[model samples]
Target: MLRITPRILAVACIASGLITAACASYAPTPSSDLAGTSWAVQSIDGQPTSARSPSVEFAAEDRISGAGGCNSFSGVYEAANGAISVRALGRTEMACEGGVMLQEDAFFAVLDGAERYARQQDRLVITADDGRALVLAPL
Candidate 1:
């Protein structure tokens, strides 16, 4: 049977280099900074929510994957210039406690309405048309 061990997990993290805290300071436009990076959700709607470790990674072929605090998700995305769009977004339906599932719902809602994105140092700010926003830092 396939199993995940702590050592394997650590190795995977190191190999993916998804930790944003230790990354070098890279200042750039949102598109370039976001095209090929994994970002961790720091806040939603301007306030930090008790969502478990949530993150998003933008990949080539218009693909994306990450956690929504409660469950892992993967889907397609389209980002160009400073505009961003997330389509076909899908996530696991696992039930979670502590309002994590609610946070996930809110997070996806913001993403669905996402209109613009900006890069502030290592942070990626995605704002919706309704002024809602998701603050993410390089993961």
Candidate 2:
């Protein structure tokens, strides 16, 4: 039989309290002000996109979804202040023509390397560490 001694009970309570405090302190930070905003890519890497420009939508749950010129992609994004990151990106595996495929690849590359973002009065620019950028406007 297991006996509950005073010392054992005290240790267990202390451990439990410590665990609870740690868990509470580890809660996720608040979402960014960009939450719930949506934009359509107007230009990528300083060049204009074709008629079928890509789009991006930022959801409140740290989710991001968008078109990649030829494929639809979804991923989780985290942003704090002006810095941003994208991870867990998954996309459809559809094929397209040469030019469309090239454009799609460029778009995905920039997103994969996203480092910072800014919102101007009527435009949003996402920039990568290597200086690649995506300029978008409201959808």
Candidate 3:
């Protein structure tokens, strides 16, 4: 046998309403902006890439692939708590034209040093421990 009490029912309704509102107030998911995004590098360490625009793609499940201005590259990346680490990069040895090689080298160096990242409006900014930064936007 069960008894219905108005006070108990009212308390349950209030708790349910609060839970629903809390869920709705949460921030938007990062996957919409990060995962599967084709981010192209615009600047590194406050200097322009000066060659071909370097690009990065964050694949699902810790995989990353991109072109570093000259050569095609693939790497592993992990992000948690707004911190990121990039490693295990492998690239094709295709020769670069003019200053493209320099740009590639610099790009890799900055990427290797990435420790954290932020999304600013329409851009993705990756920062290093030494105050260097790499700025990227959707390609």
Candidate 4:
């Protein structure tokens, strides 16, 4: 028969409690800075653009608001443990000429796959697993 002495049972209970506490402490807290912040797109692949870069700003709650070249856009954002997902993005439909449309499309594409984000001073850096980065400054 398998037997556990009182001391052994106490030790096992203590170990389990310690592990639970450690895990709870290590869990990530939802970012508060992400709310009410405006970020101006800086660079993609380390190249600067003379054209006006796209910008993203967040609301106080689950909404992500931004500008895509000639139009304003808004969406919902969900993030956990460095992974980000955007959904229900609704943008104003405006006719943008030439490069503006192209830039907007590219900006949306990158944001759709954002995996992680970091803050550097007044700047925000969003990155993907493939080493692609989008640097932005607070507006």
| Best of the candidates, TM-score | 2
For model 1, name the residue pairs that clash: 18-139
How does model 2 fare in lDDT?
0.90
* Residue-by-residue lDDT tens digits, candidate 2, 24-125: 855444488768888999988999999878889888889999898899999999988889999999999999998888888989989999999998889999
- What Cα-based lDDT does every candidate model obtain? 0.82, 0.90, 0.84, 0.77
Q: Candidate 3 on 36-59: residue-level lDDT in tens?
A: 788999998888877488999997
Where does model 1 exceed 4 Å of error? 1-33
Report the poorest 10 consecutive residues by lDDT, candidate 4. Answer: 25-34
TM-score against truth, every candidate: 0.72, 0.77, 0.73, 0.68
Better of 1 and 3 by lDDT: 3
**lDDT (Cα, 0-100) at 103 in candidate 4:** 75
Where does model 3 exceed 4 Å of error?
1-33
Error of 2 at 109 (Å): 0.5
26-103 per-residue lDDT for model 4 (tens digits) = 544444568677888888657653377888887666689888778888888876555666778888989888788877
* Residue pairs of candidate 4 with colliding backbone atoms: none
